[model samples]
Target: MSTALPSAVLGAAAHQARITLVRKYTSAAGVSTVVVSLAVLVLLWFVRDVQLGAAQVGAGGYIFSGFLAFGVIAAAVLGVAGELQAEREDGTLLRAKAVPHGMTGHLVAKLLAAPVDALVPVLPALVGAALLLPDSMPQDVASWVLLVLVFGLGVLTMLPWGAVLGSVFRTMIGLAWAMMSMYALAALSGVFYPVGGWPAPLQWVAQLSPLYWIGVAVRSVLLPEGAAAAEIGGEFRLELALVVLLAWAVAGLFIAPVLLRRMARRQSGSAVQAARERVLAKGY
Candidate 1:
């Protein structure tokens, strides 16, 4: 019985992942978003020579790192939120709630699929940087390993919060506001420029966010040792960054399941019907 349950859960998760990927890639809006994201990434790569006054090197490495981190974080948060909201409206979540350990299977599917979903948008940028700016790419096996670790930690740090946001925000407007907040944080987090150059208060606020730490970790892996001079405090405080990311991951792990269960419990036929009506009325 124990083995059967585990097998069933894995099977369900795989099935869910296949469905999510098909729906995401085959949709017109999804294709458009991917194209736009690819364009922006290429644009940034071309402009990487731009430099800040306090930086020791051109912004190329930072731009690459920032792009990588931003992609993963945004995928974990915004991507999950938008998809979950859609699923709820379309009765997908309600259907999952009906099956044995369905929500668990769904969550497992997200855990398996979100990273792949995140990568589709980022792979082009990764390839572009490697071919066009080889110096910024990780040259050693150790650095490559570190890059993987940082990326995984970043996903862990943000994925649960994405679930929370999706569960809490029932309306598109609410989700839009949440997305705007993420953009605001990205601006402050030095995705496009050096955080050290920001005002002290803004710098502090940026540091408080997981996005900034993810950027820090990425930069540490991809940039040369001397490149640390351009970072806040003129050094990479990787230990601090690790702690911050771990803290977020731990907190999110605790909070996300509770909120998800609560959200799942509230799912009903009437709620799904109302959500569909609202979506239809909005012409979305």
Candidate 2:
């Protein structure tokens, strides 16, 4: 009995170690921070010539808000996808499964660390935008606070889908495809314009994208009242943004875990070996 107890304790410790390892590995990539910086530079350059016509710098604020929200979501998804795919290909995933709590710990760590990793990138951009874009700054502290809360929740909601995709497609190419799709969806969802401005059919499609609601919620707070902000049909639809973001969060929470578990179960010997070779070849 004494021996058995020691063995169990050691097993538990090992499991915890695996989880910690996964979290550390994932956090080291820092992709979101890189992306956010790139985005800020792009935004500054793109809008350099276009002066807002009585819209206040608030228009710039609106645009940055959308970019911030999108950046969070993109970071979470890309982070998970890249980390998991790399692990899957390198046989680290298989090694993880050998430990009693390895997979569970790793997954929990990934979920926990994702938001933190995303925020590292977003916070700086927010500070810079607020300082430099005087006209587009939030009207007051309350609006800024609300925007942060809503956008943070939005990113949390989207993370599970990213995890699912990472687990399901264990290849760099597959991850790239997922990212491309995410960008395309963002475009359709009105990250750049009001979703209502799209053609009726396109509007219907845009509504399905989380970007639409996120943009709406952001615009509602930042744009001045009666600003003729782009509209969908005969109605202004900012009210739907919060609801949609919350809905996506709830849905992703339920769906992502199940999908990840299924992918875990499907991991095979050949796939694992192939993945290992790929990772080693790339020097990851």
Candidate 3:
């Protein structure tokens, strides 16, 4: 039966235009976009290193990977959600509804494009942090390559869930709450520090969110062998990390399409107009 192959193919074909648009957008983003973000990530890494001078870069390797995880989560959760919400309110989704296989195209392009969005800040930040670390970072090309691959996997692992949130919570208020919940999980997820320091209860709670596993996976690749002592149960838990991330990826793979389809089916010009009016009445 011809279920998604044709639609997915058409979507892939249509996405070239969207890719060009995203490229144009990145070009327009220019210096300030990168300069500002790199500065902040670098500064954070610097401060974190200074604060934890006991370890090299205060375990800069772990922190660096954690920072990478944070960027992925932020981009997927905040960036993707905000963009989707804006598209919905501004009738972008409605326009997609009018086009043949447009939604598929959009989703495919997103799977292709959203990581670039996540990486815009992430790549620079990672490089900057590594530069600041005078100690031996992941020096081997394989390790570096693995780090990149891990981040890409991280993006797929989380972006769909982000889209689901964007679809479910169309309002800024709802999205804000969802984001707050994410942050809460991250606060205890050992993204900035070690999980060995967290309370048992909080540690368990953090484990439930994807952020913790993401940090674990990234840290596994970037940090040295002994770094596992700083991790929960004094282990990298790479297997668990992969299982969890893969689980999320699978879940999102299935769930996002259904949610997006439902959202699309519900879209109408009147609904978009109402969203616009609501935003206007709510003020800028």
Best by lDDT: 1
lDDT per residue (tens digit) for residues 82-162 in model 2: 778877766666776776756666666666666666666666666777666655557788978876776677677678778
In terms of lDDT, the poorest run of 10 residues in model 2 is: 1-10
Q: lDDT per residue, candidate 3, 52-134, as tens digits? A: 43444354555566667888888777777877888888998899889887777776766667777777766676667667764
In candidate 3, how many clashes are counted?
A: 0
Q: Which order, best to worst by TM-score? A: 1, 3, 2
Candidate 2, position 217, lDDT: 68
Write one digit per residue (lDDT tens) for candidate 1, span 1-284: 35354787998798878897889778986676567457756776677767544445556666777778888878899999888888888999999999888988998899888888777787877887787668889998988888888888888889999999999998878899999999988877875555765678988888888888888888887877777776799888888898999999999999999999999999999999888888788865
Q: What is the C-alpha RMSD of each candidate to the true structure, in Å?
A: 2.5, 5.7, 2.8
Candidate number with the higher lDDT (2 or 3): 3
lDDT of 1 at 140: 87
Candidate 3 ranges with C-alpha deviation above 4 Å: 7-32, 41-59, 134-136
List TM-scores for all candidates, in order.
0.90, 0.77, 0.87
lDDT scores of the candidates, listed in order: 0.83, 0.68, 0.75
Model 3: lDDT of residue 127: 65
